[model samples]
Target: MLLNQFLVLGAALFAFGVYGLLVRRNVVLILLSVELMLNAVNINLIAFESYLVSAQAVGQVFAIFVITVAAAEVGIGLAIVLMIFRNRKSANVDDLSLMRW
Candidate 1:
């Protein structure tokens, strides 16, 4: 019962995150959406880790690693976004075509 509820909530969060990522133009908003998705994944991993009494802490370790990677992604991503905005005066992904070869 509890797991079902958690799964539903996680699905909802992931859906919203995808929506935000697809629909938002602001770089900050996109970062926030990615964070939401990461959080949803973390919730599932923790829930499963708790449910499974196995000695293996694979899920917990994976969740922690995901958090670390997400943190680095956000930091680097935001920095790049800021630099692009500074150079082009726009944060819209659609407007970043000039940066690519």
Candidate 2:
């Protein structure tokens, strides 16, 4: 019962994070939402591992990978945002419309 509840909650969080990422325009906020989604996924992975099996290390390993990937993604994203801001003098997505046309 409790496991199912946790799973559902984790799923909900992941869904909301994805929605926020798609809906938000700010680069920094999008990165934050991505982090939230990754965390929610990690929660689900760890929870299922702990509840379904005796081997706890696999989920932990994957969670560590996710964290590492998220950190790298954020670093790259921030660098790109800074570069874009420097070139365009703004961070707003609407400002980037110039690049499209």
Which candidate comes out best when scored by lDDT?
A: 1
Question: In model 2, where is the ten-residue run with the lowest total lDDT?
Answer: 48-57
Clashing pairs in 2: none
TM-score of each: 0.89, 0.89
Error of 2 at 5 (Å): 1.5
lDDT by residue for model 1 (1-101), tens? 57778878888999999999999988899999999999999989887887784598988999999999999999999999989999999998888787488
In order, the Cα lDDT scores of the candidates are: 0.90, 0.88
Per-residue lDDT over 1-101 for candidate 2, one digit per residue giving the tens place of the 0 to 100 score: 57888799899999999998999888888888999999999998888878876565788788899999999999999999999999988877767886584
Error of 1 at 65 (Å): 0.5
Model 1 has an lDDT value of: 0.90
Provide the lowest-lDDT 10-residue window in model 1.
Answer: 45-54
